[model samples]
Target: MALRRRALGLALGLVWGFAVMFSTLWLLFQGSSGEIISQLKYFYLGYTFGYEGAVIGFLWGFVDGFIFGVAVAWLYNYLSMKIYR
Candidate 1:
């Protein structure tokens, strides 16, 4: 079966964006900055363990996930077409 790149990208983008935003909020509520959350600042510029940071993380995550999902779907479709032919 062929995968739709746009659909996969959109799905992944939303999921990843929400995941990052919520995780950040959760940590903020807990009053502790986890190691992983802190490390995210390295990858996502302007990201911190704060309210604004959550939005930044979400945006970064969405873009990152979308690109990754699209690439994977494209590769899968291309390889499937080649192998099935």
Candidate 2:
């Protein structure tokens, strides 16, 4: 059951990270998406997409999202254990 819980946490964390990356970019770069597109460099992972943010805002947001996701997951796990126990 712990594995399931951890998996759920991880999935949620990833989604949150992507969301944060996109939304933050939009909010922060509203009206400048095109201006930042030229700065992006598409990246790929093993048979998977890595980073493909064309806009600077999105790229920045994407990175922030990754960080936020990890932090959020950690916080979630910690809080779950602390409060539930």
Candidate 3:
């Protein structure tokens, strides 16, 4: 079965974006700075452990997840076509 690239991308983008946003909020509410969360700033520029940072992280995560999902789906389809032919 072939995977729909855009559908997979969108699904992954939403999941990843929400994951980052919620994780940030969770840490913020807990009143502790997360080491892992803080590390995201290095990869996602402008990201910090603050309210505004949650939005930034979400955007970065969405783009990153979307590209990764699309790439994976494309590779899967390409390999399946080659093998089934």
Candidate 4:
């Protein structure tokens, strides 16, 4: 694949991830705290490792964001691959 293609895919992935995070958070917030507390706990479970817990939480959340971004790229690549194949 060309560099341009990769760059475009990455950009699209970041955008898709941002949208998904926003939508998911919005949906989660629509209900009372009692309704979504457990989900948030599970969502942030990636932060439960070593080091300072709070910093770990923030950093892990950043990672989660990037992974979500990559997922967007993955979907774009999938579509491209399908079309080209």
Q: Best lDDT goes to which candidate?
A: 3
Provide the RMSD of all predictions against the true structure, rounded to 1 decimal.
Answer: 1.0, 8.0, 0.8, 7.0
Tell how far residue 15 is off in model 2, in angstroms. Answer: 7.4
Tens-place lDDT digits, model 3, residues 1-85:
9999999999999899999999999999999868878999899999999999999999999999899899999999999999998
TM-score of each: 0.93, 0.38, 0.95, 0.37
Candidate 2, residues 21-81, lDDT tens digits: the string is 4653564456554433333333312111123332333444445555665666677778788
The TM-score between candidate 4 and the true structure equals: 0.37
lDDT of each structure? 0.92, 0.47, 0.94, 0.50
lDDT of 1 at 6: 93
lDDT of 4 by residue, 1-85 (tens): 4224455545655554454455445544564333432344465664332223334444445556556666666777788788988
- In the range 1-85, model 1's lDDT, one tens digit per residue, is 9999999999999899999999999988998857778789999999988899999999999999899899999999999999998
Sorted on lDDT, best first, the list reads: 3, 1, 4, 2
Q: Summing lDDT over every window of 10 consecutive residues in candidate 3, give the lowest-scoring window.
A: 32-41
Q: Compare the candidates by TM-score and give the number of the best one.
A: 3
Q: Is 2 or 4 the stronger prediction by lDDT?
A: 4
| lDDT, residue 3, candidate 3 | 100
Off by over 4 Å in 3: none
